[model samples]
Target: MRQFDRGEIHARLRAVMDRGEPIVMGGAGIGLVAKAAERGGIDILMAYNTGPFRMAGHGSLAGYLAYGDANAMTLELGREILNAVDDTPVVGGIGAADPFRDIGRLIGEMMDLGFSGITNVPTTGLYDGKFRAHIDATKLGYPREIDLIRMCRDRDVFTVAYAFSTDEARAMAEAGADIIGAHVGLTSGGWIGAAATLDIDRACEATQAMLEAARAGRADVLVVAHGGPFEDPESVRSVFERTDVVGYLGASSIERLPVERAVSGVVRDFKALRPRATRTAG
Candidate 1:
């Protein structure tokens, strides 16, 4: 198959949105996402390294350092994983950083590895004080975000920005985000509570607010509703019905299950939802 340029990917996404199909955004650790994408089980894959991973001594610190220094190990590992999946678009990057330089480096590495896009959460307000402090110390403002967006745009790479509110989503869109991802809960720690304890009504309200924010910003930009505590597909579908979100991303729910089982179940569910063809005279 021919490699798709950024314009081609964007056009494909727009066409998918036009059909009102939800882009199944599977979120997992870098390794899992790359593995799933390689199996052709995911439509879009988000490589997110949450805070807990760092606290738990999961090589996140090493990854961060590697990213900062453009370490060959990090770049090679990222490329190797991404290159495993030929069909799925693997959007690479950790969920925590500013993503200006990190994204650029990742994109360069991914391109070398034969991947196309990169994803990250570039918030004006960092969820953690340390993260905020880092950004502030660096003196990188919203303009840096705008510059990142322009850079991605120039490369034809897709950029997904996660915002906590409709206002934030709109601000990100204005700042040049190609995709606006909404955070429906306490996004700092990356844990959105449990499915049983989740307030469905509040989630719906948040989804509506995000949709309104996306509409107010740029109708052309893709909106993705994420952050979980949603109990089931019904709960997810409820938000999907009201929001302009073309995709969903979450780890809490899926991670709650055994990885292999969760992956198989999700793939089965996706297949089950497909319309059966009518039997015509052959």
Candidate 2:
């Protein structure tokens, strides 16, 4: 599998960050979406079978549901995405820290499949309080995320760690994540979304906090923001003006959200055309 070392990965990331044109990384559940993102010049493609939840008429949160095997799904889609896109590096959403699976073995398998890097998905980031504690007690929680990224770093495979808080950001950065994505809940305002309760300014503040924590661990940790107020480019730009994040991750934003808007308007336009009562001319 073609792979980018840590230096090359950061160089590519820096090139996009330096240009200020925005680095576009899309999460795709299917081949068509992956192909489309590549055509649009997306810098990276993240594959998680859960992305198909929208195709099944469910929300992106369905990616975290108990239905499918997360690792299995990602590898299945990751390979297909690589085949569909010409050169865009694909990130596999590994279900890190699952006690039922050997994370080390899983990482090796992901590398063998030609993945350019890995990221945590179907993450336990959203859970909190007793539920979160219970997961951690079982040893199948975020520690797995840290270990998984560390393993990848050992091999020099690129890694993007999804952290929901400043503390999590610190742990991930210290664990050697090449890119630390500060995820702020689910992308909202679309069909089947968790309301993005945090205002844009607050989200930016939180992202800055996360960046500060990561930098405290490693000065060069590349930080990106995703979800919530980052559901669109305009929203991201709003936050960008307020924070120092390096980039954004457009899962629902780039894929389902735009498709929903565009397809709705397109169908409406087609339906609006006058009927045969007007006598059509070619």
Candidate 3:
């Protein structure tokens, strides 16, 4: 396991940012993927709770369902990811809204496990309507995610937090998050992703709004785009052309969609290979 202090992690990311090239962060669920990502020049690897399910041919939404404990699964997956990457900073995505866990202890354990940073996932911000309201009223909500960022800051741990709206982005910046990921919605593409979501224009508008809000809270806070129409380099470039996002955080875009396309295409090609004619034997 490779360990990086908060300063070291920031320095590494800053080096990339200073080079006039955008940073790239990929989500990895397994060691093989993590190793390949690092080798391919990925600046960061996020061991997200949803990553395993996404790579397992299941929907990323499975992380939000009651299938398993999000935080625990993230930690367990983080260990595998940590072992595979040599130096790329790996951030652990924690379910900060969990009511039964001691979040402070969990943060400590993540740091000890060689994770270079932390982030919020399986976040309450993903829910809305009466369900979201109930979560807020129950003291289990986005505020806890903010508190998680604050806790990481207090411990000198780097953070890349997801924010679904301007308010969430502002709050995350105020809480000392190093990177604010402008999450427009569940990523739209791939077999199990959202069927419909914000288009490129709307995604850019939403991302810009959130990044602006984050900057208003903390002028130097880094902003990255995630989810929605950012499923490929071209689409992501559209966002870069339209917004001030410094980079992109790819979950399904990195792990699921490409794998799905590549594997399916290769299998089809193999199936298309016809047997040699019997005349060859003659």
Predicted structure with the largest TM-score when compared to the true one: 3
TM-scores for the candidates: 0.67, 0.93, 0.96
Clashing pairs in model 3, backbone N/Cα/C closer than 3 A: none
lDDT of 2: 0.82
- Worst lDDT window (10 residues) for model 3? 273-282
Worst 10 residues of 2 by lDDT: 1-10
Q: Model 1 — TM-score against the truth?
A: 0.67
Measure candidate 1: CA RMSD. 10.3
lDDT of each: 0.56, 0.82, 0.90
lDDT agreement of model 1 with the native: 0.56
Task: Please identify which of the two predictions, 1 or 3, would achieve the higher TM-score against the true structure.
Answer: 3
Compared with the true structure, what per-residue lDDT tens digits does model 2 show for residues 20-66? 76666889888888889888988888887668786566887777768
At residue 80, candidate 3 shows an lDDT of 86
Q: Stretches of candidate 2 above 4 Å error?
A: 1-3, 277-282
What is the descending TM-score order? 3, 2, 1
Model 3 residue 251 CA deviation in Å? 0.3
Model 3 TM-score is: 0.96
